[model samples]
Target: MKLKKIGASILAMAMATSMLAGCGEAQTEAPAEAQSTEATETPAAETSAATEEASATTEAKNIEATEITFWHAMNGNLETVLTEITDEFNNSNEYGIKVTLVNQGGYSDLQTKLQASAAADALPDVAQAYNNWLTPYLDKVVHLDDFVANDFDNWDDVVEAYRDECSEFGFVHAVPYNKSTYVLFYNKTMFDELGIEVPKTWADVETAAKTVYDAKGISFIGFDDLAGVVEASLHQNGVDYVDATGALFNNDKGLETFTYLSNLYNNEYARLVGEDGYFSNVLSNQQIASYVGSSAGVSYIKAEGWELGVAPLPGNVNKAANMAGTNIVMFAQDSNKQLAAWEYLKYITSTEAMTKWAVGTGYLPIRQSSYETDEYKAYMAENVCAAACYEQAKDFFFSPTFDASNDIRNTVPGVVEQLVFDKADAQTWLDTLTEQINAQY
Candidate 1:
C-alpha cells in the first residue's frame, strides 16, 4: 500500500479540528480494547467475556481512523499466505478496520526501514522484529502486557520459550510469529543400512559422525550453523555462550566444547555450511549422513529416493536448542489504531491461522494447541520435521537481546571458522572472540 504521507503535525491538527467540530455529535465510547492495569494473572476466558460485554452494551465509538498499516519482510509464498489472512480479516472484521500491508523486501531491509521510520516518528502501526532489533523502538512500542492480559483468552496457548523472549523488558512488548528452532536432519536409509541408530546425545553424535567417517572414509555430518552449535552445545554443557554479563564462551567449558567441535571439523568428521550454502542437496544426495539446521528449512529438503529423518538437537547435560525468527512489534499509536493492530495480531496467531502459517511457511506455530489442530496433525503426519521442532519447542532458548547481540552472534561463527578452517589455537581464538564481543559493550 502507498504510504498516506501525512505529517504528524498535520494529522494531529486534523484530529483537533475534527474534535472541535464534533462538539454536539452523539458520543458512545468504543469497546475498551484493553483495560489499563499492572500485569497480573487472570482467567483466560475473562478477555472473551469482556469483549462480549462491551459489544452488547452499545455500538463502537466514532473514530475517524479505521485503517492501520503493517510492515513485514515476508515475500513469495509467505507473503501470499500473510496477505490471504489479512484479506480475510478485512472482509470479516466488524470493527471496520482495514490493514494495509507493506512488504519491505527482506529482513535487513525491513530493519533499516523500521529504524529510519522510528527516528522520523513515522513507524507503521505494526511491524516484524527480532528481540535484538527491538532495542531502538522500546520507548515507542506498546507495552503489550496489558493487551495480552485483557485481549487474549488463549494467551497461555503460546509457546513458553517464545513467551520468555517476548517478555524482554519485564513485560511483553511483542508477540511471537514466525518461530523455528534447530533440528537434526539425517538420512534414514543410510542410517539403517549402516546399522546406526539416531543420536540422542552429544557424545552419540560424535560417535555416529566418527562411525560414518571410519566406515565410508568421508565426512558425513554437516552443521549448517556453526555459531548455533557453539551456543547450544555450550549451553547444554553448562555454560551460556552469552548473557547480560557479556560473552562467556572463553572459559573452561568453552574450551571443552570448542575443542570438541574443532575436532569434528578439523579431523574431517563433519563439515560446516560455509559459502557452499545449505546442506540440503548434500544430504539428499547421500553425500552426508546427517545435518543440523533450522526447522524452517523443512520445505527445502527435497529428498530424492531416500528416506529422510528429523529429530531434536542432540543434548549433553540438558536437552536444549536455539530459536530464531521474527515477532510482531506493535508501535505506539492512538487507541483505535492500537486496538486494530492488537486484534490483527490476535487473528494471525490464533490456532487456525498459525496452523496454516506453519504448513505454508515451515515455521513452527507459536501456539501449543496449534500442534493439536487437525490440519497441523495431518501436516505433521506427512512431514516429521515440524514434529521434531514441536518436540524440542519447550527446550528452546533465545539469546539475551541487546543492540550488540547480533554483532556478537555474528562474531562467534567467525571464531568457529578460524578454529576449523584456519586451525587456530582454540584458547587463543576463543579469548580473542571473547575480547571482541566484550568490546562491543
Candidate 2:
C-alpha cells in the first residue's frame, strides 16, 4: 500500500491548531452508573428467566453465542481476515455473543470517527486506535483493570514496551494487538553483486551506500526526510527524546543524529523520493539498495518479488528504536458494553487471531504465545528476513509517549528536509530547531 504523506503545509497547520497534548479526550461524559453492579459479575443477566425457559438456553449455549460491535481500520484482504476471525469466535462457542464488524477505513479516518463519537457520547463499544490518540481519550475510556483482574489476562502478561506506554491511569484502555518495529531493508541481490555483506551498523550502512553509488549508477536509499522516521533513527543512537520535564531534541545527541543524516544528503548517497509514483518503483527496481522503514512494509516488499533482507536499524550506540504499531481501545463505559468489548478484544488477540493478523497483513504478532504457535513459527521459519524486524522489537519506541512538548517532532523533519535540499548548515539548523522545540517543552 502507498503510505500517504500529510502535506508539509497541512501538518504545519495541524501543529498550529492541534493540541500539543497529543489526542484530546473525547468531549463526552461517562454513562450513568448501574443501579446494581452485581449484574456485571453475572453473564446470567443477559438472558431473561422467561426467555431461558422458552429456549432452554444452557450455559454452554450462552457461552457459544454472544455478540458485540467491533470497529477496525482494515480494508481489502486484511479486512476479510478480521471478519473471518469474528466469524470463528461467533461459531466456536455456544455463547450467543456475535461480533458485528465495521471497517472504519485507515487509522487517521478512525481517529476522526472516534473523536466525533466521543464528543457525541456514541463511541462503538470497541474501536481501533494508535497509542498517541489514546492518551487524550484516557479520561473517557473504561479502564480495563477491573475486567482484567476479574476475567482474562492482566497487564504484566504483555510486553514491557507496550506496558510502559499503556500502564498509565492505573488501567490499560488499550491492548497491544499488532505490535511492530522498524528495521533497515536492503536488497540482498544487490549486496551479493556488490560483494558487500549486509550492513549491521549506521557506519557500515553509510559506507555501503556510498560504495553502491560509486560502483553502480544508483542511489543506495530513498529517504523522504520525514519526521517520525528520523526520530526513530535518532532515538536508536542513545538520544533520550524527552526527559522528566519535556522535549530534548536540541541536545548533543539530537544534533549529532541529524548531522549524520545531513552528511548522507550532502554526499548524494540518498535523495528525497516524492510521495507519488516512482517511490516504490525505484526501491523495487533496486535503484535504491536500502530503505529504512516500518517492519509492516515486509508484505509489500515480498509481494513485489524483490529479494529482501533486514537488519536492526543501524545504530550509533544501541540497536534500534522505533514506534510500534497502533493499539485498540474502547471509549464507551457501559459495564455490559465494556465486558462485550473485552470479549472481542480477547478473542481477536488470541494466539490464533494474532497469527492470522500477522500473516494476512505484515503486522507483528503481539502475544508471546502466538510467536510459539506452529502456524506463526512456520511462517517465520520460511521468511528468515522477517526475523530482523522481530529482533529489533526489543529497541522499539512509542512516539506520542515521548513527544510531550511535541516540538522536536514538529521541527526535525523540516530541518532534515532543508538540510537535504537546501544544503542548510547542520549546527545552525539544529541550534534553532532545538531552541524552538525546547521552548515548548
Candidate 3:
C-alpha cells in the first residue's frame, strides 16, 4: 500500500505512546501527539553516511557474485554504442558479476515491465527509467552514495541542480546517463532564399516565421504542442512547476506561455501536426520551413533528405529546455550485483563511453568532463549545427511530467487544440484548463 502521511503519524504515535494508551482500544486518544519524527528527519549527511556503511557491510559479506539483468531502451544506431560499452565492462571487470543487457521496447514498455517486476520481485539490477518514474521508485531503488564515494572520479564536481535531482531520494537513483534538449531545425535553403538571419531570440523567431510565411505562404515552423514543449517554453521564461506549498505551474507566466502559443496558432505562424507522421510528411514536402523537435531526432532528420539547420531553442526570458528520454536506474538488487552495476554505470559515464554513445547515436553527453575531452570537442566542431543543443546542456530542466504529470500532458494539448480552433479566448481557456489540471493532480 502507498505510504499515507496520516497512517505514518498514527503508527509513530502507537509506538511512542503505547504505554499510556491502553491495549484494548481500537481508536486511541491522541495523547500529546509527540510522534517519533526521527526516521524521516535525519539530515541528508547522516543518511548518506548510514547508506555508505550499509553498502560496505554488504560488500564485507564476500558472497559470490551472480549474473544480473540490465534492461534498457537503446534502439537503432544507439543500441550499438550501448552494447560496445557493456561488452567492454563484461570482458575487463575483475568483479565476478555478469550483466545481461535486455532491450525492453520503448519508454512506455520499459515502465510497464518495471512495475510488473516490482510486483513479482523480479526487477533487474539495473533498468532504464524516465525522470517522472524515478520519484515513486525511490524507496525500492539503491542510491549511489556508496558507489560514488568509492569509485566516482570527480563525481562531486557535477552541477548542483543535476546532482540534487539524481540524489533527492537520499541516494543517487541513477547517474545522469544521456542528455538532450530541443532545437529549431530550419531549412537553410529557404532561409537563404528569403535573406533571413538565424534567430537567437523569441522576437527573431516570430519575425522569421512571419517572413517565411508571407514569402512562401507556408507555415515557417511546427511545434508538437505537447506538454514537453510547453514546459520548455515556460521554464525558458523562468517559470517553475512547483513552489513552497506544492504545484505552481498554473501561474501567470504559464498562462502567458499558453496564450502566446495560442496566438501563434491563430496567426498561422506555428501549426500543430496531427499524428501518423503528420510533421514528418510536412517536413518531407517542404510545406514547413522549420521544425522544433528533440535533438534525438538528428538521425531521422538526416534520413529525410532535406538539408537541415539546427539552432538553439529561442527563449523570451532565459535559456532553458526540458530534458527528454530516460535515465539508468539500478533497482534493489543483491548487494554484490549493486556494486558491479555501479561499476558499469561509472564506466559508461566516463569520457570514453560518452563519445562512443554520442557518435553512434544522437544523445548529448552528460558529464562536464566530456566537453573537456578533445574527442567530444572535435565531434562538436565537426557537427557545428548541433552546437546550440550542446550549449543548451547547462540549461536543461525536468520536463513537466511529475507523479501526476500525465494530467497536464493530456489536458494542456486539448486546451491548445481548442484555442487553435478558435473555440475560446486563449488566456481564458488556459486559466480554466490550468485549474482543472491542478485539481486533477
Candidate 4:
C-alpha cells in the first residue's frame, strides 16, 4: 500500500515512544494505530552515549563487530568500483562491520530477490534501491535520519537535487549513490568540420542535427533514454505530467514539444537507436555524429578517429533534466547492523571516497565537497567533456515518483516510440495515455 502521512505517523509514534527491545530481536513493536510501514515509510531510532537516557535510545552508538550483507545489481566495471569501495569500508571501519557484497545479476533479478526476501522476512542488512521500487518495503526499511542525521557527511553535504531525491519516502530512507544525469555526446571533429556550435537548447539541437544530416545525408543525431527526454522536455517547458486532478500535459506546451520533436525525426534530423540497442554503440560509425545519453555512458564512447565533446542537456524555458540513479537503503534488521550500515554509508559519501567512485565510474560525485576536491577537479580537467552532467546538476529534477509512478512512467516509451518511429500525432497518443494513467490512478 502507498504510504501517506497518517500511515507514516503511527510508525513514527511507536518508535518515538519506545526503545530498542534488544540487540537481535524485532524492533520495539508499534501499536496498531502505529501500523508498520510496509512499502510504508521506514523504521528508525537514535542514541548518544553522553547520557544514560540518550544511551537508552541510541544503542547504535555502541561499538560491535557486525557482519552485514549488501545486495546489488552492479556488475562489470560498475561492480568492480562498488566492490572496491565496499572492501575499503570493510577494512577501514573501526567497528567490526564486514560487508558481504552479493551481486543479484541484473536489476530485475535484484528486485525479484528483494521482493521474495521481504516476503520471507529474510532481507539483507542493506540493499540498493530505486525510489519507485522501494515503497512496498517501507515498513521494513530503516529511516536513516534519526540514526545518522547529525553526521558531518550526511544529507546537508549531498547535492541539493540528490538530497531532494533521497527524501521521496517523506523521510531519509535512502542514500544517494551511483547517480548520473543526461549529456549530449557530440562529435567535436564533426562539429568543427561542419562549423556547428554545441546545442544550447532543443531548438539548437534540431538546427545542429539538420546541418550535419544535410551535409552527410545521414540522420545525424540520436537521443537515447526517450522516456526521460520527453518527460523532462515537458517539465522544462513548464508542463506537468500530472496534477492533483489528472495528467496535465494535454495543453499547448505538451503538443508543441511533441510536434517539434516529431518533425525533427520525420525530416531525418534525428536517428533512432537502429539495430543496435544503444546509440552509443554506433558512435564510431561515421553516419552517427552525436547522441544524447547518460553521462555514465562515457565509458562506452569509442569514437576512435574523432574528438568527442560532451555538453549539458539541451533545455527549453527552464534548464531542466531528469536525475537517473539508485540509492542504498538499510533494511530494518539488527540494530547494531543498522548502525554499521549507517557508518558504511557515511564513509562512502565522504569526499575522498565519493571522488574515487566518481572517477572510476563515469557517475557524478554525490557530495558537494567531492566536486571541490583536487582529485575530482583533476579528473574533470583531463576528461574535460565529462563535466556536462555537473554543469546541469542544479537543473536536475525528479518526476512525481509515488504509488502510480511506475505505471505512469511505462506509458511514456509507447508515446515516444510513436512519436519518433511512426511520426504519429503526439497530442492524440498523449491524450490517450494521460487518460489511461488517470484511470489507473
CA lDDT for candidate 3: 0.59
lDDT winner between candidates 3 and 4 = 4
Candidate topping lDDT: 1
Off by over 4 Å in 1: 1-65
Tens-digit lDDT track for model 2 on 296-344? 5444443155466666677778664454455777665434445556677
Structure candidate 1, residue pairs in collision: none
**Per-residue lDDT of model 3, residues 327-427, tens digit only:** 67777655667666777777887777876776556566655555556765556555643466545555555532244554455566666666667745557
Model 4: CA > 4 A from native: 1-60, 152-154, 243-245
Candidate 3: count of backbone clashes, pairs at least 3 residues apart or interchain: 0
Task: Please give the lDDT score at residue 101 for candidate 4.
Answer: 92
lDDT string for model 4 (238-356, tens) is 77665334677877888887776677777888767757767767676666888777666665666678887877778778776666667888787655666677788788788888889
TM-score of 3: 0.81
TM-score of each: 0.82, 0.78, 0.81, 0.84
Q: Clashes in model 4: which pairs?
A: 37-139, 39-135, 39-136, 39-137, 39-138, 46-58, 47-58
Off by over 4 Å in 2: 1-67, 153-157, 223-225, 243-245, 277-279, 302-306, 399-415, 435-441
User: Clashes in candidate 4: how many?
Assistant: 7
Superposed Cα deviation of residue 24, candidate 2 (Å): 34
